[model samples]
Target: MSEKLAKFFKLNERKTDVRTEVMAGITTFMTVSYILVVNPSILSEAGMDRGAVFTATILASVIAILLMGLYANMPFVLAPGMGLNAFFTYSVVLKMGKSWQFALTAVFLEGLIFILLSFFKVREAIFSSIPLSLKKSVSVGIGMFIALVGLTSANLIVQGDGVILALGDIYSKEAIVFFFAFLVMGILSTRNVKGSLLIGIVASTVLALILGVTKLPETGTIFSLPPSLKPIAFKLETHNIFTWEMLMVVFTFLFVDIFDTVGTLTGVAAKADMLDEKGDLPGVSKALMADAIGTTCGALLGTSTVTTFVESASGVAEGGRTGLTSLTSGALFLISLFFFPLFSIVPPAATSAALVIVGVFMMSPILDVDLNDYSEAIPSFITIIMMPFGYSIAEGICFGMISYVILKLAGGKKKDVSPLMIVLAIVFLIKLLAPKIFG
Candidate 1:
């Protein structure tokens, strides 16, 4: 028993601190709890009900992240991801006029492709193909983009006609909740407090309850499970996978999720000191595989695509090592499934509190990029600035990649481009030009 435990936790040779492990678990829990609700909100917009989506979120987080810890031996947590939710709700369902069922089908297919790609040695090849300058840009851009999302979701920013983005009303419900959340997050982050995000969320939830903002519309005569929450006891629809529309949507889902997972892994690696000297990450392929499994499971369970969250870096920074942290985190998520009353009460304001603080933590990687070098500066600048402005993660990433390719090609350094980079560039360009070409 001791030998098996040692191998599972990698604790045989050296001493392990129970306190540090517990702290890491708390960090992972804090980071993922918000997404439990947020995933449903985004997917609900695409016609999914609340309870079923929550169930899927729990199942995916448990299965995928635990697998990551057990097999991959990485301290990253996987869950229903944020950016991909936007893509699924916005691009797939709304923009493409596809049904929610069709969208899930696409997400499932994308996961299969990602799994295949991971096995075929495409993961490292794709990463290597990306331009160095673009990679730097992606790093910085995603950081800034995540921060912008934090701010906007917190209602710190709002849309304005004259301005692309403007300050939100401080007195509004969302804005007020966001303001106090940000305040708490600032204090926790500045003090280098462990579980600072968790603190902010708890504080915000307390304040919201005191202000009489805790009540939400009940599901039925009394709150009960939504039908959609039922695990795949029945399939929704059978779409022709070979159809051009399905194929395009699947490809889009693949493109967005792969890059999103890559960017997240990169960010988390940086936070956890998991990066090699060459700035490349080990275990990324394993992480990608874990993410693919999560997405696949999420689809089968009737939820949106699942991916890695940048916020897991918080747990990593809190002294997490080995897969134990992810396993612990996943266990917490699965256990929470029975506590619907408690889970449903987590106000968006409180969740926003955690997200805003996490955004600030993620922004640390921006400092590593040398702003003085134009090669690095342009792509970084584009990514950092465009994320908030474009209001889409893929747009920001695509722009950064495009700029990096153009700059490198112009510099007569075409030979420096990797085949994967070239493939990404070509695919990205074609994606952008498709409307014009097909129209």
Candidate 2:
């Protein structure tokens, strides 16, 4: 059985064994398992049933990660994206007054478009066309964004009137617990401890429970049947398919998902030493298709855009180089269906520690950015700062792309900007000015 399984995943060729892959998979799952709770909590703000979204999140994750493993033969996991879910709830549904059904429709349409783009190789073209400086900037911007999410979730940071942001009450129990968790995670990581992030999360949760910040789950049973999907699944409202607002929303989803998947794949592949001499991942097209199909399936299952997770880096860092690692994580996601009661007991502060530490891991690529060049530095600065401050990946990328093109053109280096980038800049500008232009 071991030999057959290894042969199926090409384990030996990738210089990995079943035990290593399984351990890597467990590490990956532990780091990303926070999504099991966070995705539903965020999406429920849009009036979706929390239990239903929870079931959908896990189901979508299981299918997507399995496809990524079996078909793409890559060590990556997929789940409903972080920033995209917030955009679905806040920007599209709450701010624009669209129905949650309409938001689901937009996600569906974006996924369909992504599938077509992937099939025709258009997605790869756009990814390859991105400027090197912006690519590095996108990585750093996402790191900042993830860190900001961690800080905000743990209440270590708070809004302020005199200033845009201020520190939270360091003396508060929650804040103290979070800081301690962060310190423990950082030290363990620096000491090269495997599963250090997961250990930190467990330690934080135990502390929270002892401090009375969180309570144990009341569900006496450890296993139960998964919730039915009838409430939210396949509930997309297709009537407003062609409206300008819907188009813009779809574009935003597509733009963010595309870049996020590309960035994560590149980063994790580099960590796993899977990149070729040209700095390209082999079989990336298959991976992108897995992401596209995952998003489409996720919308149908009543969730947000599904993409490759940056948390896959934890697995790669643990010596995961073959699809077996992803397959293991996928299977664990399926098993989690009966254990939601137990997982629900985990405190948000605990998961925030993992996110903050992952943010630290993701910052390494920023060192590669050519900060000496003003043309590169200015746009990169915008990208990194805007992601956390603006609280939107799409907004950060939009500003970064627009600024990069303008800066290059102003510096008499027009050839540095791609035509696709110019068109994207115009689209972003229209998105910004649309209300005034059309109102």
Candidate 3:
């Protein structure tokens, strides 16, 4: 069985064996398993049924990770993205006063457009056209955004009317537990402990239970049948799909997914020493297609945009070099279906710690940015700050793109900006200004 598995995954060529791949896969799943709890909680806030979203989240992840393994032959896992799901719930539905069905329609349309773009190779072209500085900024910006989310969700940070922001009560039991969990996770991660984040999450949950911050579930059973998807599945409202506002939503989803997947793939591939002579990832087009198809399937299953996870780096860091790692993770997700009761009880503070740790992991790329160049530094700064301050990934990207173009043109470095970027900046400007003009 080991020989056949190795042959199928080309493990020998990738310098990985079955045991290593299995361990890598387990590490990957451990780091990302927080999504099992977090995704359902966030989407349920948007009025979707919690059980249904839970089933949908696992199903979407299973299918997407499987496809990524079989087709792309890459060690990556796919799930509903963090920032994109928040945007789906908060920005699109709550802020815009749109129905969850309308938001699902926007996600569906975005996935369809992604499919078309991937088919024509336009997705790759668009990815390649973005300036390297902007790409690094996006990573750093998303890190800050995720960290802010963690702090806010854990009540470690709170709103202040006069001051805009302030620290929450560290003396509170929940806050204390969160801080301890964060400290443990940070130390473990710094020490290169495998599954350290997951361990910290579990430890936090245990502490919360002991401290009376969260209660144990009353249910006696630990396993149960998965919930049906019928409630939210295929519920998209297509009547206003072509409206300019909806189009903008779709563009935002597409833009975030493209860059996020590209960034993750690039980072993980480099970690695995899989990059080609030109520093380009081999078989990346297939990986992008897998991501596109996953988003479409996830929307149909009643979730947000699905994309490759940066947590896959955990697997790569464990010596994963082939798709077997992803396949192993997918298998674990399949088994996770019956354990919903166990996952659903995890407190928000527990997952919040994981988010904070992951956020710190993502900030390493900021050091690569050229901070001395104003043309580069200002846009990067805007991208990094606006994401957390504005509480919207799409808004940060929009402002970052617009600022990059304006600064470059002003600096007489017009040639540094691409035509696609200019068009994107104009689209973003229209999206930003249209509400005032027509309202």
- lDDT of every model, 2 decimals: 0.71, 0.83, 0.82
What is the clash count for each candidate, in the order shown? 2, 0, 0
After superposition, which runs of candidate 2 have C-alpha atoms over 4 Å from their true positions? 1-20, 94-98, 239-248, 266-277, 317-319, 433-439
Report residue 27 deviation for candidate 1 (angstroms).
3.5
The lDDT, on a scale of 0 to 1, for candidate 2 is 0.83
**Residues 1-439, model 1: lDDT tens digits:** 6456557677533244445555676667765687877788888888877667887888877889877888887777888777778888898889988878888888788888888998876876676555544555555555566666667666677787798888877687766766787788787668877656666767877777777767533653333443345644224456467788888888777877777777667656665656666677766777778888888887888777788776676576566766777777887787677655565566766666565555556566667777786666787788767766776566777777777777767878777656666667778899889999899
- Between candidates 2 and 3, the lDDT winner: 2
TM-score result, candidate 1: 0.86
lDDT of 1: 0.71
Query: Candidate 3 overall Cα lDDT vs. reference?
Result: 0.82
lDDT of 3 by residue, 173-205 (tens): 888778878888888878887667667877988
RMSD of 3: 3.7
Superposed model 1: Cα runs more than 4 Å off: 1-18, 41-49, 86-98, 131-136, 172-177, 215-236, 317-321, 414-416
Model 1, poorest ten-residue lDDT window? 219-228
